[model samples]
Target: EDQVTQSPEALRLQEGESSSLNCSYTVSGLRGLFWYRQDPGKGPEFLFTLYSAGEEKEKERLKATLTKKESFLHITAPKPEDSATYLCAVQGVTGFQKLVFGTGTRLLVSP
Candidate 1:
């Protein structure tokens, strides 16, 4: 069976604070890991795609890194505008790469 879990389902940060969100998973055959950011009532916005262990990607204040069993999203100096629900998803090496998504981490950055 495949499963995904994210920790600290919600986080509150003051402006300029930094934190890391974790995404843990168990799967049969790993193909890729994906990170997305979703604003209220909106579809997810693609952030990164990690293919293998030691792979990493970054944009602006966000950095995503992957391991064999988990992945992390590191936010640097977060701002109030960065408040959103961050989602993690995994794709297996079986059949069209179907994705399994974790309950998102709701981040609140207050000014």
Candidate 2:
């Protein structure tokens, strides 16, 4: 079975503080790793997709990196507006449309 585990279930940061969130996974064969952001009462918003190891993507204060075993979401100089639940998911070669997801890391940024 494919599985994902995210660390530190929750994180607290001061405004402008930087940090990285971890997503570890085990799959039969990795097709893609996905990153998402979700605000309270809203659906998750797609952030990045990594297809191979050493691949990276970035937008504003957030950067996503993928490796063979895990992925990381780096937040640089985060602001209160950047706080959200960050989710990680993966699609395995066996299941083209099936995604296994971690519970997510809840990030709270205080000014």
Candidate 3:
């Protein structure tokens, strides 16, 4: 079975503090790794997609990196507005291409 685990469950940061959130996975065959940011009541918002090891994507204060077994979401100098539930999902080489998602990391940035 494909599985995903996100660390720390929750994180607290001060404005301008930087940290990285982890997403570890085990799959039969990796198709893609995805990152998402979700607010309290809204659905997840797509952030990045990594298809192969060593691939990386960046947007504003967030950077996403992928390795063979895990991915990381690096947040640099975060602000209060950057606080959200960060999600990690993976797609394997199955017929349905279903996505296995982690519980997510809740990030709270206080000014």
Candidate 4:
């Protein structure tokens, strides 16, 4: 059963605080680990593509790292405007890009 589950469900952070969010995945074969940031009214925006354990990517205050069975999204010095839904999806063995997404972790960054 290919699936993804995010922890905490929601998180609250004060501006300038750093925190890490978790995403666990279970699948037959992991093709790629994807991290996306979704705003209130728009589709997810791709943040990172982690291919293997120890792989990581970063942009501004967001950093994403992947392992065999899990991924972590770390936010540094987050701001109120950074509040958004963080979604994690994993690509399966199938050739198609049918990424199974976790429910998402809603983050509310307050100033």
Candidate 5:
């Protein structure tokens, strides 16, 4: 079976706080791992794409790293503006790319 799981469904952080969010997944054939940020009432915005283990990508206060079975999103000195729901998805190459998304991690950063 193929599934994606994200921990701590929700998180609250004060401005300047830092934390890491986890995404655990199991797929028969992983073509890629994707990270996205979704603001309330809006569609997801692409963040990163991990095509293999040991791959990593970063932008501003966020860093995403992927391993064989898991991925991590690390936030450094987060700000209130950084608050959003982080989504993790896996794509399998089964004739085509099909994305399976995790429930997502809602992060609230208060000033």
Candidate 6:
């Protein structure tokens, strides 16, 4: 079974504070690790896509990296707008085309 799970279900950070969130997974063959930011009552916004281990991508104050067993989302100097549920998903082998997802890490950035 391919699955993704995130830790620290929720996190609080003051503006300008930095932190890292983890997303662990179990799968037969890892295709990709995707990070998305979802605001309350809305759909997820694509963040980053990690294709292999040691590969990293970044935009604005957010950085994402992938490993064999896990991925990390790092926020630097977060702002209130960055306060959103960060979702991690994994694309791997299944019966058909279905993505395994992590519950998500809720990040709260206070101004």
The sequence of per-residue lDDT tens digits that candidate 1 reaches over residues 1-111 is 778999879999999999999999998888888999999999999999998999989999999999998999999999999999999999887757788999999999999
Question: Each candidate: how many clashes?
Answer: 0, 0, 0, 0, 0, 0
Residue-wise C-alpha lDDT for candidate 5, range 48-82, written one tens digit per residue: 99999999999999999999999999999999999
Please give, for residues 19-93, the per-residue lDDT of candidate 6 as tens digits: 999999988887788999999899989889888999999999999998899999989999999999999999885
Per-residue lDDT, model 5, residue 47, is: 96
lDDT of 2 by residue, 4-33 (tens): 999879999999999999999999999999
Write down the TM-score for model 4.
Answer: 0.96
- Candidate 5's C-alpha runs over 4 A off are none
Over the stretch 67-90, how does candidate 4's per-residue lDDT look in tens digits? 888999999999998999999999
lDDT of 3 by residue, 22-100 (tens): 9999998999999999999999999999999999999999999999999999999999999999999999998477889
Give the per-residue Cα lDDT of candidate 5 at 45: 99
Question: Candidate 2, 95: how far from true, in Å?
Answer: 1.7
lDDT score for candidate 4 against the true structure: 0.93
Superior candidate under lDDT, 1 versus 3: 3
Residue runs of model 4 more than 4 Å from their true location after superposition:
none
Candidate lDDT values, in order? 0.93, 0.95, 0.95, 0.93, 0.94, 0.90
Question: In model 2, where do residues sit more than 4 Å from their true spots?
Answer: none
